[model samples]
Target: MITNDAMTVQDQRTSKIILAIAAITILLATFAGKMPSGMIGALGIMVITGFILNYIGDRTPIINQFFGGGAIVVIFGSAYLFHSSIFPASAEQNVTTFMKSGGFLAFYVASLVTGSIFGMDTQTLKKAALKYIPVILGSAFFACLFTGLVGMLVSKSFYDSVMLIALPIMGGGMGAGAVPLVEIMSGKTGMNAETLMSQMVPALAIGNAIAIVMAGLLNKLGQVAPNLTGNGQLIRGQKAIEEEDQSTAPLNVTTLGVGALLAVTMYFVGTLLSSVIDMHTYALMILSIALIKVSGIMPTALEQAAHSWYKFVVGNLTPALLVGIGVAYTDLNQILAALSPMYFLLVLITVLGAVFGAGLIGWMMGFYPIEAAITGGLCMANMGGTGDVAVLAASKRMELMPFAQISSRIGGAFMLILATMVVQAIA
Candidate 1:
């Protein structure tokens, strides 16, 4: 029999080879013209291939981490290089446009509706409603106020770029709710939704990357931002743990039925509410689903359903939208030319402003220091998107890792709404 050590070595080598193949395939697919019907197919294959490789690496912990991180770095880096060279002008626009179109809409709606149907209960719903109301409303007020101040200080183009930055940050931070708000303003104002979305996606992607980087930096800085005690820890800490436990629980028919019922109800409610609110129906659907899960009316099966649904929506459905955005890239050079010196300044200001302000607020409120860093990083990510936040978070490490992920997501969502309102006021 093959020695265990030898077998393990072989597995590692195999895993690496597989991942490398996937990486090369993704690169070729991204740049080469003959692979698929359109950009959507190309992106779909790339994302799917990446995820699949990650999934296969799951059994081997070290290999998983190494390959997963490596894949992300390679793919994202190549994408950036590709964007800069081939699609520079319209890269950003392509992302924004994909985000604004029905593709994103479908992705968000599906995720929210399915998530609500199976994931939430009335009690959880009520809590989320209560929690988010103050947070979102406060964020909206502050966002609008800030936008006004910025408007007074900046040019129209500057304001436009700021809004662009805010879109992905909001989406990543707040979830799908922010997308509608971004889409609405883009559509009404004729902001070249496609172009804006394209730009926003890469920006967000870059921002997420930045957020990840910042996590490492914050740990090194040892700024001692804040630390939540038992209560806060209990509230936030239970999430991942609870989710893990939930995953192990068995699925039952009754629970599944109830979850389905609730999901269906929320979908309709979201649709109905969207007509009146001028917000994304997906947002309302998510809200509705949260209510169902929190209420505790459903069986435990609903939890599983919700998880599956979220995976479907976020993982499967959203990628298509991403691809659509990719296809929208017709004039990358124009986008680059549009980037004036002031734009860079604005980017800096926005990044620092959100990071310091939000980080300080989170720290003072007894959040973890890492969470505080994430809060800061989120200001950049939500406006930019996941890529930026990832960059920011990855730059840091240790305690900051959780914070970057959690706080940015929390803040990004809130800010998306706020940013949308800001654009509306300006219009």
Candidate 2:
């Protein structure tokens, strides 16, 4: 029989071989003309770059110590490659096309949203949902106010500060956050939606970068001050221990399929509702999953199945998802163009405001400050689904992803309405 250590060594060797083969394939495809352009090529390049950047970032002494280890590296590295034209226009287009048009992000999000909701303890879901909105509000209030103050001191107006810098940063992600807000601003300001969005994209990107780095710092704070964190839980004393990963369910191909099916179904239901109400599918999906989880309509066997599926997806797909994000969404040129000293300072202040506001309010409400800030504040400030994953991973509190989703989806929706009001009041 193979000893555990021997088996572990074998797995490592297998992983190395896989990485080597992936790298070799990408190198050949980059130079050669016959590389496929759809999912196959996209997956190949992302795997190659994601693994390499992730490995290097994690091994580097200072980068790994505080700046979200590989998470920051993957995003910035990918952005640099794309900006420098090293990613080959063909490969870049191929990857971007697959991620957006082929529905890979939607599919990935469907599983995470569904499995996370269903895997939680129902009571925790029910109770936490009641007070979480306050946490979101706290994050936004501070982020906006502080950003507005900075704007006044700079050449920009308070309105410009709030809408241009603060709103986009907290809005959610690209599609769910900025796109919809652009529509509202177009109507309110009579500027073209695309034009308005162009001005705001840099803020979202930089805010997301700051949020990811802060997540790592917040994790360190929690470690130094154990009293400030409930590990991954938001609320204290009400089943705060994370239950999503505590599945005793049998792991098999069949059960994983069942889990995937359940997640897809929930996403479909959310999409169906979106036809009637103008909201992001993710928000609707969260509500639907929470309702079912709280109502006890789902069976124990099925819950466990979902948990196992969530575990599997988060473990295997996260790195690839980050790669896709870097390839499809991150734009180093856009970020660099917006990176004047004043611009960076404004965005940094917005993110800091979010952390402090959320952390202070969370502490008042008996929630751990570190957990609250990471989930409520950084999650809002980040780029939406992709940003949430990166920030939470940096904090090493991925079990808090359900809360992070709530902050992103629900909080993002709230930002749209607030943006409309801000436009009406100031514009």
- By TM-score, the best candidate is 2
Candidate 1 lDDT, tens digit per residue, 1-427? 8999999999999999997787677556545643444345435453554354334433445432322232234334334534566533333344445455424434444444465335422332343334333332333333333533564477645455556654444454323533555576676687776776565554443444344334444543443333332211212333454445446544455544554455556667878998998655545565555555556665665566654554444444433332332333222343345355554444334444445555444444433334443434443344323332233323322112222233334444555556656667877
What lDDT does model 1 reach?
Answer: 0.44
Lowest summed lDDT across 10 adjacent residues in model 2 is found at 238-247
**What is the C-alpha RMSD, rounded to one decimal, of candidate 1?**
8.5
lDDT of 1 at 321: 34
Which one wins on lDDT? 2
Worst 10 residues of 1 by lDDT: 396-405
lDDT of each: 0.44, 0.83
> How far does residue 353 in candidate 1 sit from its true spot (Å)?
3.5
